[model samples]
Target: MRALLEAAGVPMAVARSGLWRPIHPAHVLGIERALRQWGQSMAALGAVAAVRYPERAAVIDENGTTSYGELDRRVERIAAGLHADHKIVAGSKVAILCRNHRGFLEATLAASRVGAEVLFVNTEFAPPQLAAVLERHAPDLLVHDAEFAVPAGIPAVPSDLAALVASDASAAPKPESPGHITILTSGTTGTPKGAPRVPTAMGLAGLMASALGRCGLRSGDPMVIAPPLFHGLGLLTSMMAFFLGSPLVLARKFDAEAVLDQVEEHRVGVIVAVPVMLRRLLEVGPRDLPSLRVVLSGASALGASLASEFIERFGPVLCDAYGSSEVGIATIASSADLIAAPGTVGRPCLGSSVRILDDDGRPVPVGETGRIFVSSGLVFGGYSDGSSKAVVDRRMSTGDMGHLDQAGRLFIDGREDDMIVSGGENVYPVEVEECLARHPAVAEAAVVGVPDEDFGQRLVGYVVLRSPATPDELIAHVRGELARYKTPREIVVVDEFPRNATGKVLRTKFGS
Candidate 1:
């Protein structure tokens, strides 16, 4: 217990978080009070930072920078307004659908302060999708950006972040509970489902240890979060910023050039993004960011090729985070790990456990692929719709097929359903996809399995080309690297791929 707390930066700022000074006694009490009421949540993090780093810069967005003190003041008033005017109180469900900006943070923090159960809605949802989510969740109120229109008759506070902050409402009373937060899963194949969970001291402790120890992140450094705040990657990283007293930088939309500019301007020490965003940064090329020490990738698969290419250009700074919305962050692979074993996702975090289990619930030997099961302290309770993931011996299934190497490093092969048996041999599509991505002419690739009369299943490839190359030539390239059966039967070249809001390729849209 002491080790966990110490590794999580409790008791001393200099101990683990990289801050040099001591936390004042009075400020510590204030943080303690807020945390006592808010639990280990974003609301408490914001409140604690307000008292601890009052004058420190807290947020930077299109509107400009807001210090911790200023941001917290706004959060208090907005919570008060929601309580006084909107009648949103503890346990009331509130939905948020906004891009990566101050509004998203304010809405979330304010709702949390009021002890409201906050649900982060994906900003990329279409009207029908959004409407369906609202209907199912039946949140008391919807807090959304001005551009997004909600279904008729639904209560909402639309694009009034500035107004809420400016209001002179009295402070809200203390609540009975810290309240729960729901983050929707990335619905790659079907409608997104709500995964509700709250942060606990134990959960945060393990995650903090991994970030500070393995990822080399320090306290009080500026951080740029390129992904949407609604995502687990951006949301969790934003909380890390609050805990470390770092200046949090956000942009409504990802632009590679703008991200580079922010890194140089802020001398940002850390950046959090998805793999696709990292690819964009690589495409836009490198920048002189001496202060940047960590480029954290999460919320999606990071191909070995992309990981290798990124580290080669940016020095040993790329850290690949592996987890799902349900499991939170189970493991983190440092750049050194990527350099040694490019496909590895490193090891389990400080307080987490990972195991590869065969279909019969037995452990698999090292270097043998099996279903990935994880027990991160932050795992969700269940889906909002009352369905839960399959759990074996207290650990939840990650729904991914992977193997651990001799050094205890985890390497994801692909999704469990994505593995195909071709010509009596099982093949993970990621191998073919990565093989295709290695070709000089191919920029990105996605592999899908289709029914085949002779082979039972055959792989089909879809690629976005960086340079001109014939399909036959690409197939020949793959055949040279992997087994003949692992090569795609057809390579359909396309100008671009159908991706979700976070830039994940959607194989469901493709027709083989």
Candidate 2:
């Protein structure tokens, strides 16, 4: 508890400037009034942080820096505009469809302030997908970037948020409740569903405690969030930044060299990214990054070769977070954990539990693969459609197959549905994918099963190479690493794999 509080700058100086001073009486009163009106939403966090660190930079985006005081005022003004102009009152649903920038934060915080349920729409969604999601969710207002077109029947305002914040409007007062924040599932296997979770103080603290302690994040450290704010990993880390009074550096797109530039420019202490972003950073080759202390990876699998290579090049600053949209962050792997056991997702977080259960819900033996179940306090009640995951003894299934090491570290084998039976052998594509990734010529690999006449299924490997290599030579590399049946029957070279917004490969695009 103490560590978590300290990391949040409870008694420490504000981030970047390290300014420590007593909270003025007026500031304290303002904070209390704001919280009384807005409750525990992001608006409250911004207001309270403003009272404590009024002059500190709360956000640094393309529009430039916004102090805590300015951020609080902007959020409140935007909320007032939505309330008065758009008639978005308590219980109204507001869908946000912007990339990582000040607009995304402004819209989200504003909607929450007015007690409106905020649905974060993925920016990478195709036009049809976006239209379908908006239609199904039926949000009252659609807050989107300028690049996106507003669907019919939904009231919307583009990313020119500055105008809205400055527009003539009545001040919005307190509401009956703090509205829920809904994050749509990644929808890798199916259509995305709304997963709404009302933020609770205890749930937020538990996640922060585990991440801060395991990843070496601390007070007054600047952070750059490279992933989209819609993902759980990005959302949670952004929340961590607000509470810690850290200056959040954001960009609408993830560019490897540009991210490194921001780290050096802002003296960033932590970077939150997905594994594919990490791979791009490695490809760019970091130089003179003295202020970069932690690189947090999540939202996708971090292959063993990638983890080891990142750690080797970056000198043990990589931490892998594990969880999903259904269940919030359940585990955090520290640098040491990654060093000792590459690809391990660390251990269960504080106030969280992990269980390896068989089909009938019996506990599996240590080091044995089985279904992965996690119980994080932040798990949503149910999807927006009223469908929920199967919960066995309070732990919800993560839909993954994994094993735990003797040291209690968890390693994901693959998605339970992704397992393939080839020649009467159960094979995990991730194992072969990892082996292929280790080859000097291979940059990354994705393996999928195809129906075969002889074997039940056959493995087909698609690889993006760092250097030129023939299929025969790559097949030999995998043969040297694993059994013959485990190797992919055919290797296909690709320029790049189609990726979802959060950087996971869209295997369905590969004709799987």
Candidate 3:
């Protein structure tokens, strides 16, 4: 598959950047040796980076910068410690619950090095929720931050980078095969489900090519990852940085001004964050962050108003990606595409196919809203509990309702389950929310359907305001932009919206 893609000019995307730089004979031998020792997991990728760019900065955290050489040595020792002290071995499940930083990367790479299945646990999980996850997965070991309280009866390891590095154990023996990576869903609707991933060589290559082409990320550039490492968007970008030998500038906690400070201080080139982070950065006021070339937003809806407002303030650096844990990054919209087609999520990535299908499993016409289905190598096989999304024509449903323009750009209307029926009229809350967001006073808005006696289900909006605006005025504002039926019946003004770790609004928590 890599050969086929390379033959068809897909390789040009990665090759144009120095990612395809020729490996020295010694470095090639080192990579080969490391791959044999660590399998083909993230550990091998880190080892290759260390051999090729030993002196290059691999991670910049609160403790300061750590070069690739130092990171590699630390990872080896950590892997050795986990194996020697904790008996973490091949097929062992290693749950990682930590914020974004060098420790998160260190724990992840070290676990992979020891051939353990890495389960990225959400840092925002409540104690009960965390216990439930641990009980279900029953991981062999849990590596977490010092700040977090672990569940009872789980063998745990601290995610302290210095402590792990200080260990003097030798490296663990190579496993028979590479281990898996499980990323849990945001669980906004209910209990979080694990989406396990084992990337094939072809799939990784295709995804890398697509991301590099669309995101304009080059090798060796410093990148600021502001999102939580446990989330898909953050994890993917961090892995991409490791793959490209790019220095990752990480913040333990996301502060909008701190992100800008990091970008300015490190002369960073790429910024990986979710939509909420982007909004926060904009709220921090404008600064001359000229070094930043790409601001990648994902993990939630990027409304037209927010996209336009961000681009207006930061130039054409915003790139919105649309995907979920079930499906890896399926679509990406560049700054120009966002400006041209406000709600578009851009075209299908390279080597991936997308189709909009109606309820009957038939393709919908261009500009007609339907279920979004994607077929890509990056898509996960199934949930950890043996459940799988329905597949049509070998394409898995993204569980999103969207339409494609004549030019093939995708526009997400809302989630399939988010649709509300009121008085014989179908309404997608996203439309109403987007309309509300356009209002000057509204900072963020979320709409959910409530049981109604007359209307069957009525729309109720919860909004966080940037300026003063009455409920009547906000309702009138939505009425002006959309049909009367699409307008929220009630607009509740709030100081802030309840958000998950990745900044996605928890609609379930609203009005409760």
Per-residue error for 179 in candidate 3, Å, reads 0.8
Per-residue alpha-carbon lDDT of candidate 2 for residues 252-308, written as tens digits (9 for 90 to 100): 988989999999899999999877677778888658889988999887777677788
TM-score of every model versus the real structure: 0.81, 0.79, 0.81
In Å, residue 367's CA in model 3 sits off its true spot by 1.0
Task: Estimate, for each residue in 1-512, the C-alpha lDDT of model 3 and write its tens digit.
Answer: 23544664767776765766567899879978987887667888888889989999999998899999999988999988889888999899999999888888899989888888999987765565578789989999998998878888999988885665777887788888888999986333445678988755556665677667777778888989887888888888888888778999988888889889888999999998866677678788779987888888876677788889999999998888877777788888888899899989898877788999999999999999999999887899988888888799999998889999998999988677876655424467776787789999889999998866435467999998999999999998776555565778898888888889999888889877
Q: Estimate candidate 2's alpha-carbon lDDT, on a 0 to 1 scale.
A: 0.81
Identify the superior model by TM-score, candidate 2 or candidate 3. 3
Could you tell which candidate, 1 or 2, scores higher by lDDT? Answer: 1
Q: How far is each candidate from the true structure, as Cα RMSD in Å?
A: 10.1, 10.5, 10.0
Global lDDT of each candidate? 0.82, 0.81, 0.82
Name the regions of candidate 3 deviating beyond 4 angstroms: 1-8, 161-163, 186-189, 419-512
lDDT of 3 at 477: 78
Cα displacement (angstroms), candidate 1, residue 151, comes to 1.3
Off by over 4 Å in 1: 1-4, 7-16, 186-189, 418-512
